[model samples]
Target: MLDQAWFSKVGFDWHPHRGFETVTLVVEGQLEHHDNAGGHGVLDPGDLQWVTAGSGVIHAELAYRRRPVQTLQLWVNLPRRKKMSQPRYQNLRAASAPLVEGPGSRVRIFAGDINGVHGPAELHHPVTVAHAHYEEGGSFTHEIPGDHNGFLYVVSGSVLVGPDRMPVENGHTAWFPPGEPGLTGIEVHATQATQLVFYSGLPIREPAFAYGPFVMNDRSGVAKAIEDYQSGKFGPIPTTHR
Candidate 1:
């Protein structure tokens, strides 16, 4: 899962930070980071780094020469009220997240609730993010809130979703349709080996626009973000940061 966030395939580079929230989940290995606000440090596996690039922030992920690393980064969107707020960060260790285990499956939840176990993360919207591993022939099913959107990303192996039993493989993502207005949830079955990340969030359905690293609710907002970054509103990364 190294750099699995959005699967950009750009092995973290040195660039001005983006105008959004970045939640990084380290599955293996570690990372040293440098941010424009004079923030620099190393993150170990099972660690989560939540950075709000609010108005703007510049940062980069440095290579950890120790061993290979696996990670997943998810971008969280802020509402109009918070888009221009001060940038901030939240660093959470794995111990803070809850790992629930059953006879044939295990789940580590970072947000929302899973089988009565609550996660450690807090968000602006109601969302759930979890990593699940199921042994062969293991299956799991849960009802999603009717108002939220849900999807699953296969990290390893394969799984069949829905009544049609569609097969989703590694590196592939399957977005589930919104639950029925009166239904509570859906079911997922694993006929073979399987591991996946399931995420569900309340739909915002707001207009979204993006320009490079700048993400805004509208084109005018994007323009403001660009102007602010160029005018030094986001601050500066130390020249020694490489």
Candidate 2:
């Protein structure tokens, strides 16, 4: 998560990533993204950038406007089978995103199902991701698949989660354990006006070897990734993005 007043002169320069997908949510201001695979866009509030750096990709992200920008980025790890899959990008604009409302709560689905309604972006792995807002005393309940592990990140305000009514405060996160062989119903209630993001995904259950921006299965894989990147296999940042 990043919340700051970014200036035009300072930003993330060209960087390389591999063996995972990055999901970025712009919540407060505009974010500009660019990559080597001809992917480029300006994301407004409520927008998302999903980039799969399977084999490798070079990219950059910076503030698009002169203002405060608050964004959250999640890295979805790839399984061993997909560690070297081709890179891809998806720009999910806010205008076409799906929304679910109940009482004083509203949820925007980005990559999952909510009450049988699915989100837009397709995934290599099954995952549920959403942003939600609630007024004081608002409540929401949803079922998560049994095999998935999930968490709720409180962006602001306070809320109670699960049947225990666990209190979660601002800048905190509540984790939900994996359930039994069937669906698990999770409930959330706002003690005060609240904003948060929900993320759930099936566990890969594989050993992860991470170094810098690369994640692999073992030390040898990480070495190979570094050698490949240094040998110019990831390719350079696109000229247009410059």
Give the best candidate by lDDT: 2
Query: Candidate 2 at residue 182, lDDT?
Result: 66
TM-score of 2: 0.93
lDDT at position 212, candidate 1: 73
**lDDT by residue for model 1 (1-42), tens:** 123842223346556555567778776677767776677777
Clashing pairs in 1: 1-71, 2-70, 2-71, 17-58, 143-185
Per-residue lDDT, model 2, residue 202, is: 89
Q: Each model's TM-score?
A: 0.85, 0.93
lDDT of each: 0.72, 0.84
Candidate 2: which stretches are off by over 4 Å? 1-9, 238-242
Clashing pairs in 2: none
> Which candidate gets the maximum TM-score versus the true structure?
2
